[model samples]
Target: MLEALGLSTVNESVYRAMLTHPALDVAGLAAHLDLDPAQVHAALDVLADLALVRLDDTDGTARAVRPQTGLAALLAKVEADIAVRQQQIEAVRAAIADIAVTHEQHEVVLRLEGIDAVRDRLAELARTATTECLSFSPGGAQPADTLHAEAPLNAAALDRGVRIRNVYQDSFRNDPATLAHARRMATLGSESRTVPTLPMRLIIVDRSIALTPIDPREPRLGALELRSPGLVAGLLALFDQVWQQGSPFGEVPGARAGELTPQERALLQLFADGHTDESAARQLGISARSVQRLMNALTERLQASSRFQAGVEASRRGWI
Candidate 1:
């Protein structure tokens, strides 16, 4: 413990020995500690510099001071030194803060490599968010474990009154875990919506910074952290366009028999626009099998013998 205050092991041993035998000289201390006289003398020099020992002029001998007095003085000096170093650290941090901002502004876009880096940046952004957090999670049902891991951070942002808006693919409605997560988020003041398709995974914090996958097909490879005003504005505009088209989670408008759900309407619209089944599945964040099943169900419900006939019936029913 005393080593942290600049005392060596030998110095500490010698000091302890002095406390036990207050009248011991350097030679006596060496014999007691099984050390050479030179080593004991070196320890005595350090202890004396630290005011732990003093020379008695009348006897020309070294004496240990009361530990309470000597140790207290040493502690006071250490604390003062620590305070000065802390001030220096704070000064350096303040000096770097502006430089960091300037560097980010100049770079405009930073490539975050590796999953850990991406997650760390996301956490940092969430922790510092003050006004709003907008996210687009495009894909099928989100994993329960992933949602569980993010719950605390999301809840913390909500507690700070940070408005959170999330957009997920319509297929997430079929996922029990995602549905439960959405309900929990809603209780924490987060708003969610679902659309047939989303451009990419994205996060925008307070409209000042944005994060998006560099390549949506290989999202795990890396991500881009964007701060350029123009790029951020463009992303924000795209998000707004999609948000306007999304149906609120768990609150889709009621539909009668033969009436299409929002997701079905979107599928039909994509099909009408000449999107292939595979392309539709990719856009809708579902399997081609699911798309085929939805189409088959639509055909049966419309009493159509073919996809074309189903589309005609759907159009006639204002379901498309």
Candidate 2:
């Protein structure tokens, strides 16, 4: 253990022998320890240099200093050495900070590959968001597990007083899971709206950083993170335009007595846009059978003989 304080094993042995037999000379210590006199003399020299042992020249005798004093001095020296190293580490960190900032500024666009990477980056952004968060959920009905995973992040942001504004595809209205998720978020003070179609999936935090899928059709591949001011501004503008056209998730606008409900109007628009029943159902977050039933109801209400006639009658009434 004394070796840790810079004492060699032989030096420690000699010092211990002196403490036990303060009158012993080097030759006596060597005989007691079964070491050569030359070896004992070398150990004595080291102990003397460390101030762990003292020699009386007139008497030619050696004795150990008090262990408390010797060990306390060693500890103080070790602490001083640690303090010097800490100062060096601080200097190095300060020198690297500017370089790190410069590199980050130069790298404006970052491409993150793989679903896990994208999700992790998004989670990090969400966790760090300060003022606000804007998001666009374009696809129809999202999986329940996906919404479940995202709920806590949204909840945490809301808890921090981060204003959250989300735009979801109109089809989400027909999805039970999505509706429940939206309701939960609304209760937590998040604002949400719905549009018939959305351009792409996006997330913007504090208008300073944005994330969008690299390919809207293949979101699982990866996403692009944008930090450039101009690019983020453009994306924010697009979001605002869509946000203006969307209706609040649970709001019901007043209509004339004979006017179509919002769902009916959306159905007519989807049909006029040439979307197939299957596609419409997917986009509306409903089953294909539900689409057929809605179509039948529309034809009956319009007093039309066919689906084409129903579209014509609906358009004539300004329902499309």
- The lDDT for every candidate, in the order shown, is 0.83, 0.79
Clash pairs detected, candidate 2: none
C-alpha TM-scores of all predictions: 0.63, 0.60
lDDT of 2 at 196: 63
lDDT of 2 by residue, 74-104 (tens): 7787789799999989987984564356437
Q: After superposition, how far is residue 284 of candidate 2 from its true place, in Å?
A: 3.1
In model 2, which range of ten residues has the least summed lDDT? 95-104
The C-alpha stretches of model 1 lying farther than 4 A from their native spots are 1-105, 253-258, 315-320
Q: Distance from true position, residue 87, model 2, in Å?
A: 62
Global CA lDDT computed for model 1: 0.83
> Lowest summed lDDT over 10 consecutive residues: which window, candidate 1?
95-104
